[model samples]
Structure formats: C-alpha cells, structure tokens
Target: MKIISWNVNGLRAAVRKGFLDYIESEDPDIIAVQEIKLQSGQIEIPLDDYECYWNYAERKGYSGTAIFTKHTPIRSFIGDFHPAADSEGRVLGLEFENVYLINVYTPNSKRTLERLSERLEWEDAFLHYVQQLNAIKPVIICGDLNVAHQPQDVKNDRSNIGNSGFTDEERSKMTRLLNSGFTDVLRHYYPERDDIFTWWSYMKTVRERNIGWRIDYFLISDSIVDQLEHFQVDDHIYGSDHCPMRMTINLH
Candidate 1:
C-alpha cells in the first residue's frame, strides 16, 4: 500500500497551492496530514475514494492531524494517554486489519524553547501510547515529528545545536523511541545520506539553497520492516514549508 504524509502547514492554503492536484497525481492508498489548522465544521475536502478522519484542535487555526484511507478502519481514536497535551489535536489513530496507523503532529518547542519541557513530556507520553498499540499489533506512524534527530538530519547541525528542534534533550527522545521498537523508515534505507530533507525554512533563499531539516517521518514497528516497499522524501513537491513523504509497504 502507498501512504503519503505531509505537514500541510494549513490545509486551506495548501489546497489553493495545488494540494488536491498533487493528491490526484500521486494517488496514494493512504494520506496522513499534519498541521491542518482547522476545527470541526470549518472546512471540508472532497476525496471520494478515501475515508477521511480528522482531529481538530480546541483552539482556532492551530495544530491538528488527519488521515484519508482507502480501506476501512476497524476502529479509530483521537489523542494519546495524556489528554491535556492533546488539546491541540495532535494524535489520531486508526486500527486496520493488519496494523494500527497513527497520524501525529508533534508539538514544536518554539523558537525560544519555551515549550521544550512540554514537548518532551509529550514525547514520553506519545511513546507510551504507541507502545501499547505496538503490543497488540505492529503500528505504522507518519507525521512531522518536529525534531531533526541526528546531525545528518539538519543542514547546519553544529550551528543549530541546542536550538528548539535540534537540542540534545529533544533528539534523545527520538533515539529512545527508535530503540523502544520502531524504525525510522527513510534513515533505515539511506542512513548516510545527508542531502535529503523534508522541512525547509520559508525565509528567502533558504529552501532554494536546500537548507532544510528532515523533521517529517514514517516510522514503523521493527517486525514490519521487511514489508516496506518504496520510501522517499518528495522535496520536489511544493505548497508548504514542509514537503510530502511517501511510504509503500506490504501487509500480506
């Protein structure tokens, strides 16, 4: 199955920038979206072939996540173990026949690191939440994790050190998460490649120079690693500061 994940930044703006056109072109089996920035009844997107689910933030025009899948889910849920952290509607989970799929939008620690502590807490709780699902069946995760986990993940690793997304504490959570039983799908395939990046600064000439961070991800349970087919960062597509990523895998 082909799955595409994107941090749209804002679904409305993204649609104006050709989001639907891109979807029509790629025709993925599943689409996971982050930062939808909309509330219930605010808007609707027409995707006739897929069943769509959304978790909207309590606040206006803020964090949210969504999933569109061709196959029916056995069950679905919003939020994680920590309901307080989920006010922003960051986690949305769907259970299918073979796997539990989660679309997540990890909280940004903010430029001044004001929210770093909270972000870290969310990381731990998120790990706890997914581990429980993983125990029942292998899980498939996709979204913008907001951290450039490794030096290879960011364009200027040294200069960006201690910054919000690149801080030691933030990266450590990612490391521990992977160790806990998931695989960073892209890195697993191209561990040494430093040129590939998913999220770029919108500042003038930043994306043009290809100065970006690999923040968006597709992570999967270790047992399903062999079923993975095509995995890639679609830097070529545009519409948001962050680009879309694709993962195709076999469950059968």
Candidate 2:
C-alpha cells in the first residue's frame, strides 16, 4: 500500500493551489496531512472516494491534522495526549487490521526556543504513546515531526546547529525515538542521501535554491522494517512549505 504524509501549511490555501489535482494524480491509498490550518466545514472539495477523518484546533486557522484513507480502519483515535496538546488538533491515530497509523504534527520550538521546554515534554509523552500503541501492534507514525534529527537533514548544518529545529535538545529526542524501536524509513533506505528535503523556507530563492529541511517523516516499528518497500520525498509537487512524502509498504 502507498501511504503519504504532507504538511499542507493551510488546507484552504493549498486547495486553491492545486492540492486536489495533486492528490488525485498521486492516488495514494492513505494520505496523512498536517498543518491543515482550518476549522471543520470551512473548506470542501470532492474527495468522495476517501474516508475523511479530521481533528480541528479550537483556534481557527491554526494547527490541525487529517487522514484521507481509502481503507476503512477498525478504529480511530483523536487527541487524548494532554489538554494542551489535544487542543491544537495535532494528532490522529487509526487502528487498521495490522497496523496503528498515527498522524502527528509535533509542536515546533519557536525560533527563539520559547517553547523548547514544552516541546521536550511533548516528545516524551508522544514516545510513551507510541510505545503503548506498539505494544499492541506495529505502528506507522507520520507527519511533520518539527525537528531535524541529524546534521545531514538540513542545509548548512554548521549554521543551523543551534537553531530551533537543529538544537541538541530536539535532535536528542529524535534519537531517543529511533532508539526506542522505530525506524526512520527514509534514512533506512537512503542514509547518505543529500540535498533532498521535505520543507523549505518561503523566502525568495530559498526553495528555488533547495535550502530545505527534512522535518517530515514516516517512521515504522522496527518489527515492520522488512516490509518497507520505497520511501521518497515528492519535491516536485508544491502547494505548501512542505512537499509530500510517500512510502510503499507490504502490509501483507
């Protein structure tokens, strides 16, 4: 099955900029979208074939997430992580016959690191949540994780070292997640790959020059690593700061 994850920045904006056309062409079996930035019923397009599951932030035009799946899941879970975390509508977990798919938009440590402490706490709780899910079945976790776990994940590693996404604290949390039996599917397939990224700065010539960061990911439990078939960043499709990432896995 083909599963895709994308941080669409804003669902309404993206729709106007060819979002539906792109998804129709890609035709992924399951698509997990982050940073939807809209409350329910604010925007609608004909996506009749897919079952839509959405978590909307209480605050309008802010962080949100959704899953469009062709397959019916056995169960679905909306945010129950914490009051603050749940309020943002950042997580959606769906249980399938064999895997628990979690769509998450992790809190970003702001440029000034103002939310660094809270981001760390979220990381810990998220890992615990994943661990609980994994104890039941293998989990497919995907979304904008909001951190670059390695130097190679971003352009100009030296300059970005202490920045919000590249800081030691954030990177270490990602390391802890990987160490806890989840495989970073992209790195698992292309460890030495370079210049490929999911998110780019909106500044003029930044994305044109490909100065981007690999913040989005599809991580699977280690037990399911062998089932991973292909992982790629679809840099050509554009409607948001982040491009779509696709993974083909043999669920059978």
lDDT (CA) per prediction:
0.92, 0.92
Per-residue alpha-carbon lDDT of candidate 2 for residues 203-228, written as tens digits (9 for 90 to 100): 99999999999999999999999998
**Stretches of model 2 off by over 4 angstroms after superposition:** none
lDDT tens digits by residue: candidate 1, 1-252: 999999999999999999999999999999999999898887778899999898888999998999999989998899756664468898898899899999999889999999998888888899999899899999999999999989999999999999989999999999999999999999989999998999998899999999999999999999999999899888999999999999999996
TM-score of each: 0.98, 0.98
lDDT of 1 at 217: 94
